[model samples]
Target: MTNRLTKTLLALAVAFAMPAVSFAQDTCSNRGDLDEQYCDDNHDLTADTPTDPKKLKTPNTLVFTFTPVEDPAVYDKIFKPFTDYLSQCTAKKVVFFQVQSNAAEIEAMRSGRLHVGGFSPGPTNFAVNIAGAVPFAVIGDANGYQGYTLNVIVRKDSAIQTMEDLKGKKVAHTAPSSNSGHMAPVALFPALGVTPDKDYKVLFSGKHDQSILGVNSGDYDAAAVASDVFDRMVERGVISADNFRVIWSSEKFPTQDFAYAHDLEPNFRDKMLQCFYDYRFTDELKKAFAGADRFYPINYKKDFEMVRFVARSAGESFNRAAYDKQNAGKK
Candidate 1:
């Protein structure tokens, strides 16, 4: 039985269906910002099928990944229960492929090595534009969705009392493609009387845990990170919430997205999404997720619009050139 959210989503998909065959002759022309390998004939703001039948795929073994925030090994363990359920549901081997970065995860899906995965909020647009990923769900239970806020943290004893105090101090951002960690700061900070690159040179900490840990250890004067990751670290005793002071925090943004490679066979795609929606989080998984349960429905063009707005405001696009530029500075 389709749940209310799934039913509504299916209806929306049908309503958005276009005469895709008519547009195939142009070989993905007028795809807007999407990569040339895809077409958006439906104007649904996502990739459509390849005109060639041979381009569609339904692999016997499905690959899955989660966005790299903390230790990949930790998430590998955290997601094990879900993978086991997915394998049984699909009657195929499901394997969790550990990804070291957002770029690598998107590339894996683009190259057909990854079947489904979670993408961080900032890079979700990049995955849609450049990697042909179709986002469908996020971690949530009965409450509808999961969200996080951008938290600017400094040591509790630090003299920084306001955003202005960040000037001339070392400030860390998680990665170039992070919503709370980087892009939101670039977009929201200037209005608050602190400019990132001008007020202080941005330091890339590679991950949220690193940024928080850097602040805790005094490696940085302050750092911007997602509140959820910070809470998880505190719960796990990696850091204490009391040890830091939040100088600034932004409104909640949607957490990471779960998306599938766009070229999947229609039936396979439906079944894959159903499998995720039907599964409930285990007790430990719920606690780890801060109480989010099942994978809840979402529309990429709607749910991620704010993230795209922030990216655009920062003069950023998810194109290959932009992706390469960000990763080029990686240590």
Candidate 2:
């Protein structure tokens, strides 16, 4: 979903929004394309600053937000401690922001209000390119880097006993941009005799947790999701592991990413990275992490290459044109 989001330059007027600060409304010029409103800035794309810096300045109030991967309200509690730590570590007022859609999350960062954030599987590229976030760490344990597998799960009593048994049945994939939940299944399930959109009718469940719950409730015959998310659901007693079984699992794939904005001052940037690695998950956080205990260090070029390959295999190259197209229809 976050196509070439990495290289994106935020559209000036759209990306640099400053709240509580107003601009003059433009009256339409006759016969102009409705969408074609012209904007001219000094050589730099940023809005022309006020002659005196004070007029253009906004106080720095560090904002912390997370990915839109799950219900924001619930995860707000899960991440409370981290937000508190950011407040202490950065010595700036920090607030945890919850967003309901991909666009809101992107806009928050692009507008320069967002300081640090966690981005989900596909949208990290967009957060980076359009928002100027720099990737640093991902939640993981000492055993190895944090990762998830694409799992095909079914109700414990469902007659879908094998991957081959899923033929002609209804199946759910989280969304187009999801890796373990959608892309991986499409790229790897053919050998199982289930070619999505062909052998089976595919449904969009909107999220991995929903897909997992759907399988348990018989709303779906089978669904693909991130293994860690499924495990955490069981661990939370939100669902029982015994209620379902995995019929198929794909190669291990990268987990969620943690990032900071690229425009952050240098000294502040170093401290944020240190804080991420040093913050240990307490028991409750471990529960939220599905049993993970700490943040894992990663080198994007190496750890994420396999993910890039799988995405490409599924026809998503993570380029700008594709990202714009994906974002075009989104509200």
Best by TM-score: 1
lDDT digits (tens) for residues 1-331 of candidate 1: 5698899998888666655644555655458788777889888788987767798899899999999988888889989999999999988899999999888888898889998999999988888888899999998879799999999999999999999999999999988888889999999999999999999999999999999999999999999999989988887788988999998889989998899999898888899899999999998788778999889999998998899899988878887778768778554
lDDT by residue (1-331, candidate 2, tens digit) is: 3755644644544566643243444432231111122221322211222234333323267777777667778778888887788678767777888987656776787677777777776666555545545567788888876778888899888888888887899899887767777777777888777788888888989888889888877889999889888877777788989888888888778788877655566656677778788888978888878678887887655676676666777777554455667778776
lDDT per model, in order? 0.89, 0.71
Sequence-dependent TM-score of model 2: 0.79
Error of 1 at 197 (Å): 0.8
Candidate 1: give the clashing pairs. none
